[model samples]
Target chain A: MVELLAQTGLNAVYAASYISLVAVGLVLIFGVMGVVNFAHGELFMAGAYAVVALYADMHVPFFVAVAIGMAFVGLLGLLMEWALFRPLKDNPLGGLVASIGFLMILQSLAVMGFGVRMEHIPPVTQEVVRFTDKVGLPVARLYVIVAAVVFLSALWYFLKRTRFGWALRASAQDPEAAALQGISITQTARIAMFIGAALAGVAGALTAPLVSVNPHMGHSVIVTAFIVIIVGGVGSLEGAILASIAYAFVHTFVTTFWDGVLADIVGLSLMLIVLIVKPTGLFGSADRA
Target chain B: MRNFLILLVGLAALIALPHGLSFSQQEILVFLVINVLLVTSYRLLTLTGEWSLGHVVIMGVGAYSSALYTKELGVYVPVSMLLGAVTAALLAVLLSFPLFRMKGFYFLIGSFAAGEIIRLIWKRFREPFGGVRGISGIDPMPDFSVGFYQFDFFEPVSYYYFAGAIVIACLWILWRIEKSPVGLTFHAVHWQDKLAQASGVNLRAYRTLAFAIASGFAGLAGALQGHYVGTVNPNSFDIEVMVFVLTWAIVGGTATFYGPILGCIVLTVLNEIVLREMGLEQARPLIYGAIMILSILFLPNGLESLVQKATRRKTTAKPEEKAAT
Candidate 1:
């Protein structure tokens, strides 16, 4: 029982790692843009396809492909900022509807390019680290866990210790005040969008080999991200990370013990409970959410 | 008198419409009528300044309830459908307890989570909902002869007439609700809730009322869908359908009553007829997405703006715009 519990803890850690990556990016974009990006999951899918093309197809190094995936998806975010979010900045609803439109465009593009079927990515590594006969972590999965920690820590340092990070947060807090303080609102929004998009992309790229890569795969990822962000608090970064960890444990454990559908139900129920009890979330200030 | 004449002419045209269309086109018309109900009901919910991502799921709630009521409890299909709608409205009331705590983006996401839970419930239970495949072999609306036409369930035109009449009735009721003092209060709740509250408007109650009413109509639409299609699956009412409803509401512009209905008709024609004829089925979503993005950028006010521009009758357009947001 102890070994099983440890194994589940490790699984939850891995789950929390990638989930926080996606949730944090979602929080960042919402913080800066004040628009709910319905197309974010597609951006993650775009990252996975980046891996499929560069790493799996072109035979580039795995880490390099992951980097390209991150940058490429970030560029896509820049495109969205220029085209959709910028013009609809004042109209949050318009921005949201436009993102839904963009989601369709991305999904259809994927269907057209790769077909609707799942693309099997070759295993990047077959090695596993074992603590017991029945308890083991695959090296590929470990890569996702490690990358999430490194990228998230770097993001933490960037936000807290860097000048632009402060500017980003300032803009997120109050756009007009930030603008008066000599921060460019447009530039901050672009940077936030790019970084946000890159994080989701990198998470998708790292986990591509472990899951089925397909056009519709983003649907579940986006759902999970929404659950995490809502439970975490919409604009609070730390809340998102903590909520991601909490949700990962509950969801992974429930799925392990019961069923997948029930696990989804439980996760969504938890989000609803949070919204009812504390609409702002566990770590969120009431004003932000 | 002039308005009455226009109504008569419109009714005649609608009654005559299916005769000119092919069988498939007639079927599309039936679905379109049902969708007209869905989108218009969605507008009613938006009237309170909240857009719900789970409206489609609420529609599914009605579908499953009505389907099961008829299938399991041996209720009349029509009565069960009404009960289904009532069930949906009640469910909305229940959900509003938890959901109305959050406003704006939080409300949107909260509604989504509530909807997802409901959908997962349908997916998890196999006894009645039939799991992922959903409830199939649903009971159809029994055929009856109208004096002007012998209604046939097998033929799509007959169902079109039946659904058309029901939809017209629902729209009439919705129009009355919008025009009434209650509608003004809904608008008040939307535009300046705090001030309205100062003036004794129960903001929460009004919001919940609008949500319940909207869910009821959406449920009715779902029942219409189930009876016509003879199947009710979880996949049938997914986010894609909700996105379509949102697209119609946004692209057609929500400022006017006719906006979303107009959007529903035009987009349906474009998606079903124009794209289908061009033989670009696979590229349909791509083209549709492009249209959505382009229109949002250029026609932020929606197709209703164009209608207003062409008619040159500026009546209430400006005031309505303020109330719209």
Candidate 2:
């Protein structure tokens, strides 16, 4: 019984890794740009598709394909900003509406480029660290765990210690103030968009092998991301990461114990309960709320 | 008298539209009416500066509630529809307590989460909502004999008219609400909630009331849709549908009362005409996305603003020309 709980804990941690990557990016973009990029999940999808196109099809090295996928999707984010967001800067609703439109375009493009069928990618590693007969961790998943830790730690350091990172944080905390302090809102927005998109891309690329890759797969990810953001408070990055871990544990455990359908229900119910008790979320300050 | 005449003419045109078009076109019109009703309900909450993205889920609640009641309890269609709307409204009221405390983007996310919770409930409760496969063979509205004529809602034209009437009724109520003192207060709250509250407006009550009214209308639209479509699926109320409704409202212009109506009509027409011609299944969304982006960049107020601008330009030009002449 103890072993089973330990195994579930391990699984929860794995889920938390990728989920935080996606949620943190989502929160960062929202914090800086003040626009919810509804097409965010599609960017994640684009990353996975990059892997399918490069490594699965062309036989590129797995890590190289993942790198290429992250960069490519990050560029897509830059394009979105230039084409849609920058033009609609004054109107948050306009930016949001445009993102929704972009989401549809991406989904359709994916469908056109890759048929509706789920693309199968060969496993990057078959090696698993067995703790017991029924408990083991796949090396591929371990890569995700390690990548999340390193990237997130690096992100923390950059935000706390680096110059550009302070600029990013300052812009997010108060754009007008940051602008007055000589921080370029435009530059900060671009940086935020790129890093945010890249985070989502890396998460998608890393998890592509674990999940079914399809045109519409972004639908669920975006939904889950939204739930996490809401539970974390809309603008708090720390809240997003923490809430992602909490949500992932609850959802994954429920799925393992009961069913996927019920797990979704319980997950949403948890969101509602949190909202009812604390509308600003656990980490969201009243001012931010 | 002029306004009454316009209304009569509008009603007459709507009544005659189905007869002038093919069955498929009538089906499209029915769907358009559904979109119109849903969009109007969405606008109701937005009037108070509270945008509810999960409104499609309220519609889903209505759809599923009525669907299940009729399918399982064997309830009469009218009763089932009423129950559905009530349930959805109740849920909205229940959720508003928690949701209303959050402002702006937080509120939006809260409502969105609530909607997802509702969808999750439907998906989980297989016995009630039919799970993933969804509830099929929903009994259509039965025939009714009124003195000398029998009316059946099963026909596409009849369903269109029925749906259109509900839509018109909803629009009328919304129009009345928009013109009411409460509506003025809602606008005031939307523009500046702090000021409105300072001036003795109970912001919480008004916001909650707005959400309830909107959710109620969404439920009505959903119920009508279930009867019209004769099927209820959990997928119908997903985020994608919410995006479409939001797009319609945004494209039409959120500033005017008639924006959603115009948006629904234009998008529905474009979707029918252009989506059919493209042969590329994904082209419609791509084009839709392009249009939304361009519209947002160029016409922040929406397509209605364009018309308003054009009319104003003409009126201004006429005065200048008269002076010159």
Candidate 3:
């Protein structure tokens, strides 16, 4: 029982890693750009497809493929900002609607580019690290977990230790005030959009081999990301991380013990309960609610 | 008198509209009519200054419940649909307890979570809810003979007319509600909740009222679709459908009652007739997406704004003559 529990715990940790990566990116975009990019999940999908194209189909090195994927998705994010969000900046709802439009376009393009069938990328590695006779962690999953930690730490350091980070934070907190201080809102928005989208891309690229990559695969993970961000607070990065971990544990345990659908219900119900009990999320201060 | 004449002509045109279409087009017409009701109900909810992502799921509540009433208990189809709508309204009231606690973006996310939970429940349960496959072989509306026309359940044109009549009646009721003092209160709550509260308006109650009423109508729409399609599935009421509703409302401009209806019709005509005629079914979503983005970017006020503008010009130009007439 203990071994089984440990295995589940490890699995939950892995889930937490990717979930936090996605949620943090969502939070950052919402915070900095003041728009919910509904196309975000599509950016992640685009990243995964990038890997499928470059590594699986074209024989590129795995890490090189992931890097290109991340860059490509970040570029997509930049395109969205320039084409949609920037023009609709004054109207947040308009921005959201436009992002939804972008999402459909991306999905349709995916369907056109690579048919609707799920693509199973060949496994990157075949090794698993065994902690015990009954517990092991696959190397692919470990790559995701390690990459999440490294990227998140780097992001944390950037936000705290860099001038661009300070400018981004200032703009997120008070765009007008930041503007008064000569911090260009457009520059910060571009930076935030790029980084936010790249994080989702990397997460998707890293997990491409682990999950079935499909045009509609974004739907489920986007729901999971929404749950995490809402539970963590809309604009709080640390809150997003914590909420992702908590949600991952709960969802993993529920799925392990019961079923995936039930796990989804439980996760969503938990989010609803949090919204009812604390409308600003567990750690959110309602800065931009 | 002029307004009445216009309305009569519009009604006549709608009645004549489906006859010129092919069989598949007539089928699209039925779903289009049903969607008109759905989008309009969604507009009613937005009037109270709250936009719910759960509106479609609530519609599903009506569909599932109505289907169950007919399938499991053998209730009359028409009566079961009403009961299904009532059930949805009651469910909205219950959900409002937790949902209305948040406002704006929080409310949006909360509604989405609440909706996902409902859909997941339907997917998880197999006994009554029919699990992932959903309830199939639903009871269709019974055939009947009117004085002038024989109604059959099998023909898309028949179903279109049937659904069209119900939708028109629902739209009329919705219009009446929107024009009433309660509707004024709803607008008041949306535009200035603090002021409305100071003016002795119960904000929560009004929000809940709009939500319940809108959800009830949405349920009716769902029930109408279920009977026509002869099936009810969880996937049918998913977020993708919700996005379509949002797109219609947003692209139509929600300031006027006719706006979303106009948007829904125009977009449906474009998507169904033009896209299909061109043999670009695969590129349909792509073009639709491009249109959505273009409209938001360039025509942020929506297609209705153009109509409003044209009317404003006509009214301004012919004020004296119009008044004299």
Best candidate (score: DockQ): 3
| Model 3: fnat (fraction of native contacts) | 0.86
In the range A82-163, model 2's lDDT, one tens digit per residue, is 8888888877677888888888889889988898899999999999999999888989999899989988888888888999
Writing each residue's lDDT as its tens digit, candidate 3 over B102-185 gives 888888988999999999999999988999999999999999989899999899988988989999999999999999999999
Name every residue pair that clashes in candidate 2. none
- Which ranges of candidate 1 are over 4 A from the true structure? B313-325
RMSD of 3: 2.6
Task: List the candidates ranked by DockQ, beginning with the highest.
Answer: 3, 1, 2
TM-score of each: 0.97, 0.94, 0.98
Weakest ten-residue segment in model 1 chain B by summed lDDT: B316-325
Q: Candidate 2's residue-wise lDDT over B127-181, tens digit each? A: 8777777888898888776666456776788777667767788889988998999
- Candidates sorted by TM-score, best first: 3, 1, 2
For model 2 chain B, the run of ten residues with the poorest summed lDDT? B316-325
lDDT digits (tens) for residues A93-197 of candidate 1: 788888989999999999999999999889999999999998999999899999989999999999999999999999999999999999999999999999999
Chain B TM for prediction 3: 0.96
Each model's total of backbone clashes: 0, 0, 0
